[model samples]
Target: MTQYQPIAAAAAATEWWRGAVIYQIYPRSFADSNGDGIGDLPGITARLDHVASLGVDAIWLSPFFTSPMKDFGYDIADYCDVDPIFGTLTDFDRLLDRAHALGLKVIIDQVYSHTSDRHAWFQESRSSRGNAKADWYVWADPKPDGSPPSNWQSVFHGPSWTWDGRRGQYYLHNFLPSQPDLNIHNPDVQEAILDTARFWLDRGVDGFRLDAINFSMHDPSLRDNPPVAPGAGPRRRPFDYQHHYYNQSHPDIPTFLARIRRLLDSHGGRFTVAEVGGEQADREMKLFTEGFDRLNSAYGFNFLYADALSPELVRHTIDLWPGAPGEGWPSWAFSNHDAPRHVSRWAAPAERKACAALSMLLLMALRGNVFLYQGEELGLPQADVPFELLQDPEAIANWPNTHGRDGARTPIPWAADAPHAGFSPARPWLPVDPEHVPLAVDRQEEDPDSTLNLTRRLVALRRREEALRCGIIRPLDLAAPLLAFERGDGPDRLLCLFNLGRAPADWRLPEGWTVIEAVGGEATGGSVPPLAGLIARRSA
Candidate 1:
């Protein structure tokens, strides 16, 4: 018997996220409505048709809730309400209705670890020691010398603890000082989070992508982190000088994940994916989604942070997720708002187009669910954001040493000739790059051979073939630069191969195999051209 059944049936069985193609939308850069220089829910609603045309199953919207925009919506001020800048709650409802009508599931970002300084919860928690929500956030007394409680450093800058005069104590902030860490160990806080989840679930949300989930809980003892060994790598900031043991990845995370899963399960059909980033991300990811009682999936920074994409890198990343019973399904994305684009990281000046095509094809062919970032389909390279225009805090602070994430977050050009490339009537928060104008969606829509079309073809193949959708992957033994794998080896089988080197790699399409999709130069039976990929199938 073959695992070649129609994927549509499996999709209808409430496990649509298992092998679904999720497109990530960085709301601020995706589209702008109201001529306010920022993308809003209405803007996203208008673009849903374009997204649906790409054949993706869902969209993972980045944070867009009520916030101060200090960390660009990650520092959520209100988890249950829509931010005014983005739009009103009514606007979000409209967007959801439109997306569901298009047969596209919608998932939103949930930042559980922290809340913005402007959030009512944080404000109350900081008001006084005896307030009802005084202990809702993590707070610790300072050391004898009035320094931070521990050596834990924040991801953005200096110490993780900030002095709060109101409480006469120091509060934990794993990111910006304005974003206070939630005390998930507190039972009241857990219930509060669950209530928040229910609020959205009641509104008919399909899922949530938990942000920095591992940071939701911390060691109650307030212990210092272990110092890093000498010369591990270049210490970018104080945060890089420690092993990050006590401050994050607490054992209680899985228990909370079980609570989250149970809550979503109560909703009958929903999805949950965690974003776990750190040195122990792999271990934490497995633990968080280890069984049926936890999250449905989790994605690490494997491909997102890799300096180069290669056969060995893909092989190593795939091997981590077995896709077997009892093992959690893995979700993958090469680029997101937080990281630089893959083409920028993997290819130089002239090779971005080929690199983008190859990576897109490869992402869709993988065994588990995959996410495609906005603008990736257009083969848009990372825009050059100089110091004067840099918006990302980390990038601004680490200028020259690090290019940061702003380059990859430039506004997506809709029309090649329009002012601001049709992004908005007014200037966008992020400038539209001149180089990206030629790669606009409208321009690609006019060319059948464009990377955008390649994405559509590849995505259509994923939807049409069970082998590429939900089938198990088996790596084929091949020399360097030639990565090959088999999907659904029984019937309706597939052999997906990629040539990652500068030169073409030889490969013969097995007898009786039919080409499904090919991209990047000629993907003929004789060879897979450099920076190319081929998906071929065999039918009984």
Candidate 2:
């Protein structure tokens, strides 16, 4: 067992989550301990050493609660118990204990927006109209013509409302039909969800990553959403046809968030980061984390779903949050379980290494907390899951039009020579990408200059420099292909520059600044190489 070195009490007391690097682990694809072809809590516990070595402050795990595997754990059946496939509650406790021993905070995903149809609450709600849990889920009466209650659409594809013959009405679902939306407007529902959070806190969880928080509350009147303009990008499903105004992003969400914040405040030093995405993501993200009374931070799809990485995009996104008074902190993620790996999305095959290194430097320099996905440190690209093995409901629904999320949720490559990349002794849930074999953790550990090691160095650099960790961001005026910014905190000032193009670029060095760290390419003769990133500090 490795000795634990706890962070200083003084630094953690104020705010440890600000500018923290959180590594996200998609539990189903991370590792399989029992060789049942599924990743479990014990698997994650066994892999804690690798995660702790990355210099990340915490680990944000995806849902592992009891579920029917319809949404791969997202459709949670039990809010308080661990799934049998992921191991028992004891296994979770052991995992949490091990993580805390290694100085890593544990942040679990909280899906308060909906629950599985098989959940006890939902089963009872859908059983009879006047049962104990009758109004636990969003239910509405059908129109006289017998169509859905409104024009709302599920994220999976078709109508959001499903007919429930037993209740003689329609039940709303923002996602799959099996995952019914919770009636958070009900005070009893709010109390039950808050109790779930309290349960986890009592069990020693450090924080929560609230999933699809904006979808928690919906328009009570069930008003129709207006259609979007004709040329609003490609529309694979009916969900993209509308502006999504009334279906979600209701004003009552913040009131519920305040209740959650109050509960977390009682726990002390705990954090909460809400995941808000959609057309109104920017506004809702700010609303959810605006003051000290709500969530600590919020992240949207600013970079996750972007087609390209450009200077204008970076500037525009960073400009949204200025860290002014009363404004909450921001969190950023380029790649996660839901989105395609950024290396494949942004860079060509030939320049992936350089692009990965540059992206890491850029993420570390950004003025917010950063999230790195499971295999991101290895520079892993999106896997090519075949049609036969497709498991994601959304991908299977809309075939070739939408490249589904299964490609991004493939198993992580742990060993270069082992079968299934050492993820499981048996057949894994998702196939391992052949290209990822060469970039496995075992192979990268042997090479000191590998992407995995580079990530560690970058994370350490951010931790060592106060300016990079919690400094104010000031965008520098630069031409195309070059994105430059300065992070300053009193006397500590650092200038960060990145050449996001395939050609070399040059910038006149400031009089007092000197290069402190250079990755991917050298910064010499007042020029930066292709896909290079440079960090320089001003001399006192």
lDDT of 1 by residue, 1-540 (tens): 122222334443568788899999999998998898888889999999999999999999998899989889999989999999899889999999999999999999988999999999999999999999999999999999999899999998889999999889999999999899999999999999999999989998899999999999999998899989989977888899999999999998899999999999999889999999999998888889886899998987899989998889988877787654567878899998888888989999799988988899899899888999999989888888878988998898777777788998999899988889998989888888889999999999989999898899889989988777787788888998999988875776788888999987887777887777787766776877788878887755
Evaluate model 1: give its TM-score: 0.96
TM-score per model over all chains: 0.96, 0.97
User: What's the true lDDT of residue 216 in model 2?
Assistant: 95
Candidate 2, 1-540: lDDT as tens digits: 211122233653489898899999999999999999899999999999999999999999999999998999999999999999999999999999999999999999999999999999999999999998898999999999999999999999799999999999999999999999999999999999999999999999999999999999999999999998999767889998998988789899999999999999999999999999998999888999986799999977899999889999998888888776677778999999989999999998987888789999999999889999999999999899998999999999999887789999988899989999989889888899899999999999999999999999999999988778887788888998999988865457899999888888876677888878988767778788888888999887
Residue 476, candidate 1: how far off, in angstroms?
Answer: 1.0
Q: Clashes in candidate 1: how many? A: 0
Against the reference, the lDDT scores of all candidates come to 0.88, 0.91
Clashing pairs in 1: none
Any idea what lDDT model 2 has?
0.91
